[model samples]
Structure formats: structure tokens, C-alpha cells
Target: MPAINAIAADKLVRLLGTPRSPAMIDIRNDAEFDAEPRLIPGAVRRAFTSIPDWAPDFGDASVIVVCNDGGAAGHGAAAWLRQAGADADVLDGGVIGWVGSGHPLLDTAAVPPRDAAGRTLWVTRARPKVDRIACPWLIRRFVDPHAMFLFVPAPEVAGVAARMGATPFDIEDAAVRWTHDGELCTFDVMVEGFGLGAVDGLARLAAIVRGADTGRPNLVPEAAGLLAISLGLSRMYPDDLEQLDAGIAVYDALYRWCRDATDETHDWTSHKPAKSRVRA
Candidate 1:
């Protein structure tokens, strides 16, 4: 059995895609990572030697520390994080346990460059309705939990991205790598690109996003409703970032519904019993 102080990989997997997910820190050494360069989904790499330098940065947030096999590295980091006044835990078996459980891992090589603060910066068209919001939601939740977005005029997306060093996305340009790919929408591309396809619910949500964003509502039954809600949200908020902040909750609900509540139905009398079995 694993140590009681650590959480199982399965439990952490379910938490990874949600807002309540703890800050995940992978503290594997260079030689260990050279043998396996993948990262647990939604996890960021931190040098074990620099724990003192970075531990204070996450003083207010809970953290999960991971190493090769739940040895001295993760233990030391968790201790440092706790010493810094943050709630922290170690992975039960570290990356080995995570991979052994068949959980998803992301290819770190495919991830875009991060800014000074370790956030992936992105630019997209302003006045987002569906694709733009959904793509950011996907990126923030699954790809880079600390992703940054800048909304600009459609004509200036590429220019702003070049000048500001942000990756341009959800806009049409042959040079851009994050746009729609033929039949798939930006959300679909993002989900696939970030190696999140293992989650069947997210894949279904991607279809809905594609249909909603691409004017192909017939492809998914929920597409029209999503589009309607997205447009309404856009109208409600004048600030693009405010709209995105709201959209994050929207997609969060949608993702949970897709993941856990799709087959569920509700009625006022769900708790009420039938009329004594028809008085038989």
C-alpha cells in the first residue's frame, strides 16, 4: 500500500481538470526526465534545488509535489512547501505510479514557450463568442493552468502576437499553428494538441465546441445552446477578460455535465414515490 500521507494517482487525475486542482509541481531530476520526458497532465516542472526560491511564490495555494518514485526529492519539496505555510502533499508513487496507473502524460516538447513567470501567453481575436472562449478554457484547464490571453482586433492578432511575444491562436493564418484544421474547430485542435484526448467526456465536449464555433450546429445537439449562451455572455460583458473569466465557469459547468451528468434527468417529483403501485 502507498503511504497514507500521499494521494493515489487516480484521485489526482480526476482533480487535474478542475479549478480546485492543487498546484502540481514535478521535481524530477534531469537524468530521470531524460529517461522519460513526459509530464503528468496539468503539471509544471520545478527544479528541486530551487524549492526555497519558488516555495514562497505559492504561499497561499495548495500544492502537490511529485518526483521519480516518491523519494527524497518530493518529500523535501513538500516539506519546504509546508514550511512556507502552504498546504502540500506528495504523490504516492510519483511519476512512476502516475504512469503505471495509465493516466495521461503530455509531451513537454509540444508545449509552447512560457513567459518569465512560467505562463504560456496567447493572442486571439477580440469579441470572442465561442471558439475563442472555448480554446482558452481548454488551454487553461488542460494545457497550461497559468496561460495568459490577449484579445485584439482580428486584423491585429498576428501583429500583436509578434510584438508582444504571445502565441496567436483561433485565427486564420497559414503561419499560425493553433487555428482550425479543416473540419475541426480551435477547441478540437487544442484538446488534441495538448494530449487531453484520453478523457472521453472532453472529446465529446470538443465536438460540441466545434459545431458551435464552426456554424455546423447540426453536428452536435448542444452546439446551438452553447453558441446562444456564449453570445449572450459576450453581450453581458464589455471587457474581453471579464467575459473570459465568466466563460471559464461556463465551460467548467459544461465539462462537469459532460463528464458526470449527461445521462441524468431531473423532475420536480424525483423524490416522490409512485401512487402505491397503482393500488394493486
Candidate 2:
């Protein structure tokens, strides 16, 4: 049994990509981190000794601390965070447990460098439709919650990425790692590249995104609906960022439905056969 103020690896895995997920603080030292460059999805590296100072940065959100093992560092950081008046917990067995449970961890070393403000910067063609929006949703929810995206002209993507130290994605180029690969859309590429593909819910959403983006709405029944909503959203907001803000809600709903209600069905009436109550 785990100690008080500690969360089991399986429980944390179930909460990984949801909004209810705690603020994940990776407190592993340099040697511990070098042993495995990948990180728990959406986790940020922070010095365990500095918890008393930076713990408040998390505000009211619950925090989870992790180390190479759940021995001293994780417990110490959680204790400090609790002393700072925040709800904190230690990963029961740390990253080793998370990994041992077969949960996907993001490969941080493969991502682009962060800006001085400590945010991953990305650039893509403006006026996004499907893959573009979906990729950002995945990034924000599972990679960097504070990641910055630059929507620019299609012709300037390479230039802006080069000059601004931003990772260019969803663009047709050899250097971009988050673009299409044959039959897959950029959303599919991101889901696979970021280790998100293993999540069944995300995989379901990726299939829908792929169907809409690849001009094959027949791939999934929901693809046509997604395309329609995406087009309407593009027309509703002239500003790219505003459109993205609105789109995020739509995707959030879809993701939850994919996770929890995919098997549900809807009909005009709850009646069956002779029990029909609402007009035929």
C-alpha cells in the first residue's frame, strides 16, 4: 500500500491527459533524467530543492511530484509543496512505476528548444482547418500547457521558424517533424510522435482527424461532422487565435466523448417498436 499523500501509478495513468490531471513536477536530478530523456506526459522539470519557492507558481491546482524513484526526492518535494499550502502528492513509485506500467512518456529530447520564457514555440500556416487545430490541442493538453503557436502565411513558415527559433509543424517540408506521412494527417503524426497514440481515446480522435484532413470523410462517420464544424468555426472567427480558442472547446468535447461515450446512441425518441412516443 502507498503512503498518505501518494498516488498510485495506475490511478495517475487514468488521469494523464484529462483537465483534472495534477500539475506534474518532475524533480529528478540530472543523472536520473539522463537515464531516460522522455518525461511523463505534460510534466515539467523543476528542482526539488526549489519547491518552497516555486510551488506557489502552480496556484490552486493540485501538484504531483516525481523522482527517479519514489524514495526521498519525491517525498521531500511533496512535503514542501504541502507546507506551502498547496494540495500535493507524490507518484507512488515515481517515473519508474509510470514506465513500468507501460504508460507512454513523451520524448522531450526530440522536441524543439523552448524560448527564454520556457515555452515551446511552434509556427504553422494560418487559417487552420482540421489537422492544424487538432495538433495544437494535443500539444497543449499533453505536451506543453503553455506552448506558443504562431499562425503565419504559408510562405513565411520556414522563415519565421528559422528566425524565431520556433518549431514549424503541419507544413509540407522535409524538416518539420509534425507533418503528414503518406496516409496520416498532422494530427496522426503528432499523436504517434508524442507517444499519445497508445491512448485509445486519442487514437480514436486521430482517426476522425485523419479522415477529415485527408479528404476521406468516409474513413470515420464523425469526420464529416468535424469538417463541417471546423469550416463553420473558420468562418465564425476572423482572428486565428480566437478561432483556435473556440475550436479547443469543440475538440475537448470530442475527446471526452471518444473516451467515455463512443458506444452511446441517440434517437429522436426513447421508445422501441410499439413503444414509440414521439411521432413514428
**Model 1 lDDT, residue 122, Cα:** 94
TM-score quality measure for candidate 1: 0.95
**Best model number under lDDT:** 1
Q: For model 1, how does the per-residue alpha-carbon lDDT over 1-280 read when each residue is reduced to its tens digit? A: 6675577888888887789989899999999999889888788999998888989988868899989998777888898899899898899899988888888888787789999999999999999999899988887887789899999999999889989899999898977878999998888887788777886489889989988999988888999999999999999999999999999999999999888889987676544576633342
Model 2, span 239-263: residue lDDT tens = 9999999998989889988988898
TM-score of 2: 0.91
Q: In candidate 2, how many Å is residue 107 off?
A: 1.5
Q: Evaluate model 2: give its lDDT.
A: 0.86
